[model samples]
Target: MDVELFKDGKRLDGRDVEDLRKPLKLEVGVLQKANGSAYMEWGKNKILAGVFGPKEAIPKHLANPERGVIRCIYTMSTFAGLEDHGRMGPNRRSIEISKVMREALENVVMLEKFPSTIIEVYVIVLQSEGGTRVSSLTAAAAALMDAGIPMKEPIAAVAAGKAGGKVILDLNKDEDNYGEADVPMAFTKSGDIVLFQMDGKLSKEELETAIDYGWKGTEKLFELQRKAFEEEYSEPLDKKLRMVE
Candidate 1:
């Protein structure tokens, strides 16, 4: 718990503070049963997200008459971490994450357009290195878009921190476990902050630096999101165009 996280002015993984782990991949429409779906790999984390509903809200009394309700179900597979992989069902941590994630997505989705229904988003972490929550947010956003859910714009998230006396852009598992402060943030394409959470503490100046890195990181996440959509359709679209030709 007290090992040095930096050496030679670089992270233990040899990344500069602003570097996101390489091989950050995103794909969409990976789940045939869901209305929309996406898969993401960030560092060692692997996540899948699926969207369903905007369908009739069950138990009519709980349905919102003015707008659709956003329900985010965030879960981790038993094998998702370095732990024993024995837990099942919604644990306290997953329940809390699901609540916060639901709030974050509620901001981007134009729920009012679908009135009196439910928009359920399911995000499952298949593996974890760290920052799974923010990665889940990114995948869910893409899945929602894949489902053709109306949104003001795409949403993306990233985790940054102050570690080993430097501001770090993305925290892998080791950094998160030992860092001075961990800050995870979600943002819209236009730079509006949607969700921000912090653990540990930081001076105001350090906090500002983390936020700056967080926003920049989200910009990258948003671009990958766009590519997920293109990856989902480009091949099929090319065949259609060839047929037309």
Candidate 2:
């Protein structure tokens, strides 16, 4: 039997099969024309998100009389990758992602503040090496803050992978694809998880371990998000908004 060990009996690029790489970067207020926007890069995964309104609702039926409504659109950019499909358009995958994202966000935002208004969130996946959903969630939260939308709390999301029988935090592309399990979690800065998803099979113990990794990773991400949020408020953002990311 030819057994290719990931890294000395661990998964490839090992750090206990679940240990993730460092160097996560987030940029807030990237789109000058949008009411609020942000970009996030986690390893090779990249996502750009924009938040618009509390604007007057469009299509009379879509309007709500008691609370503001949220509409989320998620799409993949053409240049995100050329390895497989080259075309870009609304597909089943994008539709499902958009719906889930909207549900996740609507849970925390204060919609009652803007009744009869619409809050639009657009997430464009620039790269989808791994954990794109988590990245989108994190980016959306940042964009919402930039737009000055009041939320119950800031949400931070991260993915955990189990490789070589070990749980790792924040899986990159290869780890996510080849790993035994993938678990993504979204949480508030206060340590409350609001959204969770899992792929592949896992024992109860394994699931707990994955959740632990996700929580730790989310905490790490929260600090970066906070810093980004503060920088936007410190001064007027230039075109590049290249001040202290």
Candidate closest to the true structure, highest lDDT:
1
Instruction: Give the local distance difference test score of model 1.
Output: 0.89
Location of the lowest summed lDDT over 10 successive residues in candidate 1: 236-245
Query: In TM-score terms, which candidate is top?
Result: 1
Model 2 spans with C-alpha error above 4 angstroms: 1-5, 9-11, 14-18, 239-245
Whole-model lDDT for model 2 versus the true structure? 0.82
Cα lDDT tens digits for candidate 1, 1-245: 67899898888999999999877999888886788888999999999999998899887876998999988899999999998767758989899889888999999899989889998999999999999999999999999999999999999999988888888998999899988889988999998898899998989998898899898888888889988777777776321122233
Q: Can you list the residue pairs that collide in candidate 2?
A: 6-12, 18-167, 18-168, 18-169, 19-168
Model 2 agreement with the true structure over 1-245: per-residue lDDT tens digits: 23343666655555555455545788898897788999998777789999999999998789999999999999988878537646778899888878878888988899999999999999999877878888899999999988999999888888886755677788777766677778888888788888888888889988888888788888878898999878877896674444564
lDDT for residue 91 in candidate 1, whole number 0-100: 88
What are the Cα lDDT values of the candidates? 0.89, 0.82
In model 2, the Cα lDDT at residue 238 comes to 79
